[model samples]
Target: MLSSSMRHTRPRQRLINPFARATARPGAASSSHPCPMAGRGAATAAAAWRPVSVLDDWVAREARPISLRQLMVFGRSLTESRLISSANYVRTELPSRIAHRLRDMQQLPYVVVTNPHINDVYNLYYKAFDTFRKIKEVKTLEDNDRLCEIISENLKGHLTVIPKLAMGILECRGLMNPQDLDKFMNTILRSRISRRVIAEQHLSLTETYHSPHFSPGAKLSESDFIGEVFIRCQARDVIDRCARAVTALARSTNGPDAQVPAVHVDGHLSASFPYILSHLEYIIGELLRNSVQAVIDRQAKLREKAVAAAAAGSTTSTTLNAALNQPPPPIEVTICEAQEHVIIRISDRGGGIPRDELPYLWSFSKGPKSANRLENLGQVPRMAATMQELHIDELARADLKAPSYPTPPPPTPSPLQQPPSAATPHTPSQQNSLSSLTSRPPNLRLGMGLPLSRVYAEYWAGSLHVHSLEGYGVDAFLQISRLGNKNEQLTTRASMDAV
Candidate 1:
């Protein structure tokens, strides 16, 4: 049911991080690296004090490169030390007063932007540092700044090259706290959108099918079907919980921009479709959660900028106000029934999936860019080895058949000839021992819920289907068979009697 626009072109492969490759190579010479202590003196300082060169060799020798794990550890260590150490020092030291200013601004009702030039400063430093580190070529601050400016001005050119991992980290910490409930609401919206799209697509595919006949008089008495009601009610409860979770997430991330959308159904008539109500509710919840998170992430960056602007005593509050005033993303759900099947659709207004990446959207394996990066980092070999082991185990299990139960012997007539000895008589505990050997409930295992639901539905001659989008949402459907001819005749007679 996904749109063709959701398909994204495959991104060009990135160059492997040579530093990672160098670190992994066995017997690589560690001695060629310059000593870290040699960079202290002044004139020799500029030449010997290349931070990247000194750190790279030290990291290579230590067998730990600058990865996310290393960064987290470094940050924790810095927080613990607290002292103004050379390790944590930036070349351009901002005034300590700036920290006090930010702390005060945090108490305000809205975000404060303290430094408009902070991004420029970091960009300048990164250019000089990156060129020196990556190419092992020395460059002046002026040269680096010009190059950085050029790249900055053409930001759209580097969209694909920008690491998604880096973006995720920035969104998590620098943007907004995701733990808030409103952030989850957007996720539900997304799920609803996906379901709507799928449902509409399915309807279009079978337009020739007749509309389903509704039998209003065929309702069962409440007392006769209490157990069935309880089961259906339990499913409804889960669906309601999912809806609340999505709403919370959306509100938290959207800040003042969040708007809770009203849920609409084409009456409860479609509830007659087997499993449709439960599946629709649950999947809508999941989609809304994803959408809420996406909106929160997207808006967090803007909020950070707003905060920074407010801190700087800038009078231009228009940008921040505009961002806060924006409306929440839309999620739509639609349902229709056909003679053979019922269809449900959910759609979202959030940015659609990229065109080229659609082929692998439903794949269980790593996403396109992530998988490519993993391969480049030499993780594919280990992953392949693990997969092989799993396959071997599966094959072995498939070769073994289940053992058959033995038939019981007929009762002997001689048993009535004499009373059994009381000393060897079986007790209640002994009699119940065989009962304990029976299989326990299967719901205890992870990943079995969907399959178990499918099994129960199938018992009544039904089929279950699940459709999902990684960054978008999920849709689940169940279809039950129609009643047999004799049952239909009986139902008509019963309907006449009730009338």
Candidate 2:
């Protein structure tokens, strides 16, 4: 929890928002708008500028912890007065949360602070803090509208933050010990999750308030959303949905003809719980994708070894062909519902991770050895942003709520089947969005998925664990709290004794 206290505060200065200015020059002809070069120059100038004081008085303030039940209670009976109150609460609360995080970043060691990716993230936090700090109290509907636009833009701008932080930390792995490194990352990531919840929740509330179907004092169901959160989310539905989407991603990545394994969902199939939809989708999708990929790779490797042996006359051609033609085993997902938590186990026969890679499995630093070759991979993949955009099919993109999953795409020629001249490389711009599903090999393996998925799980007092059986397979256990009363597991400034 963040506590409020006043410190000696520096005089406030009016800040110029270059992005806003360049895009909103009043009464100027469209031709007179600043060119790209001019905009870049403005951005550079903004980047170089910082306030005299890094810690605002608000940094010491205390804010109440948010709970799922609280959100539902607030959302159920929203009137004009309640909306305005919510707006003001959000307006003040966001900066306070952001301020504390900014302080946490400020306390980092100089070496860690100077890492390029960390520096970029630090600047982003500062800009967001400053932007929110400058906004006058949001009291009216029009004021709330402007605040929503700012929130939306900031959310988009911070999409790459998780990847950037991971990359920077990976580069600085040696500077800090594993314990401190995990501490710092846990703090930052949990803070990131908290900030997004407040901003996104407010945005959703505003949207609901303005919807044509909205009535100020009418009865609203508990199922009525405060944001992307669902009060009574169906767990099995999310798991099945994410499984299908990840299957499509696998097919797209490994080529259309890839034999992606089927996902078998069992145990507590009708379980419902209160949770954020996107968060659940992201965690489940990442775990399933990993399992699916592992299955595909293991099967392919088996076929290769068998074929090589057959060529060496150690095995018959008939036996080799039969092995190669067999379908990979299905990925098994079992959901067990308990009084306080929902436990999901995803088991895959994808030949478990090697012993050497286990130490760095849930780390931001000490990523996969392949991470060193990131220059060829463009930027580290955006985890949160990409997860938000994950879909089972093209049609799902159009209607995320109540998604109508379209028929899976028909198989096309694999690279080996196609003529050599037919395969072209995908550019970074084309592969950035998972919606494209055309990422080049190695770009998708930054080693952030499982670690970040753990963060999302732990954010709600849930847990994720993976157990490998070496040559046989791997099992991932995910526990989510259905109670929805656990306060966010946040690290405060007082806890910043380490790196």
Candidate 3:
């Protein structure tokens, strides 16, 4: 977590508040105000000058007002001292004016400062400046009371708001779900575009390193590859631009009424493909659409409930407005690397899949057991036909084995039997023709994305695996041999050219 305290560390010279000198004490004489040189004589003048000099030193040391650097140092010292309880109470009770200023200061970046004694001095400075500011604001008794009341209210409000905001931000960025085929596809698609951009950028950088006219045969090292990867990873503007493109597409399809969706990328080298980049953009768009629909559905349900509740004069009613005001759960993305594969997981902390239906989650078929039973019946007729064919073949073979007995009597034809015909052996051309017809495989149905992906992987001499944890998440993995150096170089060159 990023610390808010680090912001409060600017030099006192930058403080905006003006300092005022303290007033002198009441006069003891008409011509001079307790001047030892004239009242007590020259002997005590040197001693009087000594006190003034000491006072001058004190004023010089305390001249500067409070600053952020002092406050941070103070806060850190208090933390180190294990005075958290006291520090927290003070932070809460701190005057709104001072606290607000401190907050503003906290927004600035500062280098970390150590030194416990200096920190203590810094804390004292902050406390003193806060007290001074309060005194300066207090023009009347009523104003003081009002200031106190306002500070009290703000402190209470902050206690609730700060933690919630922190949690929301964390939820927005953290990873929670297992990686599945959808995730892999999405990642792969996004990575493809990113890789292309990276490759282009790499080419630009390569030009800076050496002229393109230089030998293409020059050996490229691993450092070059790693450097390119690092640059792509660190390029925030590029990533944001890609995300914006995705968001725009999603909004165009889903409409202006839809909420802005969160987008994240994950995985290692496997997820860094050129094709995966586009797929990721598309998947994100679809997921955002689904989320919008879910929200709309929930709202409709709530409105209906509210209407019913109003008619019945019931106090309890779940309405869209009420739900909209409530905080929604966070979305998360997790990235992990394992042997020969990478996993990118995403999860939304919304209402999960129903427990009762979990067992059928990964089944190609869905619905009740009766429906499955009905499906089995459709296969029974085919099985019966095959059994009957086998029985006929067996009978024919038995008859041929008992040739002596069979010659005595001609067999009676059954209703199911066909008249005998002359047997004709298939010629070579006919056999080849039959073989060609039988050898052709059946056309598969479309939208079998998982199987299709597996086929693609196998085509590249790789493998794809998937597992879904119902009501939880899904996990997917793709395994492929590491590209050889020569192949990698070729790929790099091709990628650069495409870019």
Best by TM-score: 2
Every candidate's CA RMSD: 30.6, 11.2, 34.8
Clashing pairs in 2: 2-62, 3-61, 3-62, 4-61, 4-62
Give residue 349's error in model 3 in angstroms. Answer: 3.8
When 2 and 3 are scored with lDDT, the better candidate is 2
Give the per-residue lDDT digits (tens) of candidate 1, residues 85-203. 21122211111111211111111111101111112222323343343234222144333234333323322222221122122222222222322211221221222222222222122
- Give per-model TM-scores: 0.28, 0.80, 0.27
Per-candidate local distance difference test: 0.28, 0.66, 0.28
User: Cα miss at 420, model 1 (Å)?
Assistant: 47
Candidate 3: C-alpha RMSD after superposition: 34.8
In model 1, which runs have C-alpha deviations exceeding 4 angstroms?
A: 1-241, 249-270, 276-282, 298-316, 355-357, 369-499
lDDT, candidate 2, at 202: 72
Candidate 2 lDDT, tens digit per residue, 1-499? 0111211121232223222333354322222422112333334433544653555576667656788878767877767788788878878888888777766654454345545576678788878888888889877899988988888778768877877777666666666676777778878888888888877777766666676666776655544444445677777777766765676677767876889899999999878788876677778878988999999999999999998999899999899989899999999999899999999999999999988888878876664573553443244454454453433343233222333211113221221110000111121111222232323342156566787899889988899999999998999999999888888777665556334
Rank list by TM-score: 2, 1, 3
Output the lDDT of residue 213, model 1: 21
